[model samples]
Target: MLQILGAAHGAGRLDPDEIDERQNAVLRAKFVDELPEQIDDLPEGAALAAELSRQAAAASGTGTGGTARSGPAPAGRDLAPAWKGPGGEILPAHQGTGPERTRVDIMSGSEVHVEPGTPRVLSYALMGGSEIYLGDVLAPGVQVVVETYAMWAGNEIYVPPGVKIVDETINIMAGNEIGRHARGDGSNGVLVLRGFSLMAGNEVKLDPDWRPGPAQLGR
Candidate 1:
């Protein structure tokens, strides 16, 4: 059941809220019969095959529901405060400031390629992950704000050589790491990272073997 929810999220078929809603329903079910009936209630095309499979299993009385697990709770919607701007105004879900700047909100997963001349970015990740690729060159004082909340959520920013990074992020049971290859000589530009992370991690690295593919380049 959880696998179906994960797949739907990965395919962009379900947003975080819907995922959480269905997950809680599944977790709270008291019988195998309740599982398949709830599966039938999912949005169209979200889990057709899973619905059929679970229905068959329930008909066979394979197992009951609500079994206890011995680990941390499954990843779900976070209760962190809404992301706010520097002035303390709540930022919208998704928006772009200009042609060269963007605000990204990630719940399941996403990837972004930073184009040339782009100056700033606001990124928020909850219950999922995101990757930002900074191209080979950057203007001076480029800034990227990344906030990740909840367990298993993370962000990875790839930087090119010769570019320096200044990180100013608050972390609670979370942290950021800069890879050895990403250490810069301060000759290209300074990339400032700002934001907070809770029970998550952020990484800055220079992946020498990685390059944007055609799809990412086109975007």
Candidate 2:
């Protein structure tokens, strides 16, 4: 069980708080029946969880081969239905107004160039870094959510001129810095940033030199 949790954490599938909570539950279990039957937070961990339950039941002499104990599910196992987008893609927990583009970086670096059609951008960084560059001319009401997790992770958002940036990100033992930029009077829709940095850093600034051509801006 510890191995499974470790693997999930190392793969950036589970956050530090989740691993800590699950490990505490495992350590406090006095009997095999008290062990967790499933990792409810992990959408794809059902099979492994079931196998662990079956093995635990067999080892405790509560059931024979090919048979496992059956009872009501443990508390906290009931999760709300996941949010899905128009195309059936699962969205983040705090998705605001829905995002046209979602960029994720895990243990690596990535760059995302926002175009005209995309009004909302969701950028996630886990144990890695991500740079988001806003187009020169942004549509009205453009919003970007930059989330960074794990230690040493960072996210950078480059804002061009004539755009008002609204910072709404929460930082926990993390740095959230907004560099000086040419302020706009909200003519172009305000760029609202919303997300949290957990033991990480997120920087929002103006960069005037990065001008990527249309060919470089892939969907």
Q: What is the TM-score of each candidate against the true structure?
A: 0.45, 0.45
**Residue 74, model 2: Cα distance from true site in angstroms:** 73
CA shift of 164, model 1, Å: 0.8
TM-score of structure candidate 2: 0.45
- What is the per-residue lDDT of model 1 for residues 165-189, given as tens digits with 9 covering 90 to 100? 7778777887888875466544335
Please give the distance, in angstroms, between residue 59's alpha carbon in candidate 2 and its true position after superposition: 91
lDDT of each: 0.53, 0.55
Task: Show the colliding residue pairs in model 1.
Answer: none
> Which ranges of candidate 2 are over 4 A from the true structure?
1-99, 136-151, 210-219
Question: Model 1: residues >4 Å from true position, as ranges?
Answer: 1-107, 136-152, 209-219
Please, what are the lDDT tens digits per residue for candidate 2 over residues 25-86?
Answer: 65334444455553644655566666656755666557635345444333333121111234
Which residue pairs overlap in candidate 2's backbone?
none
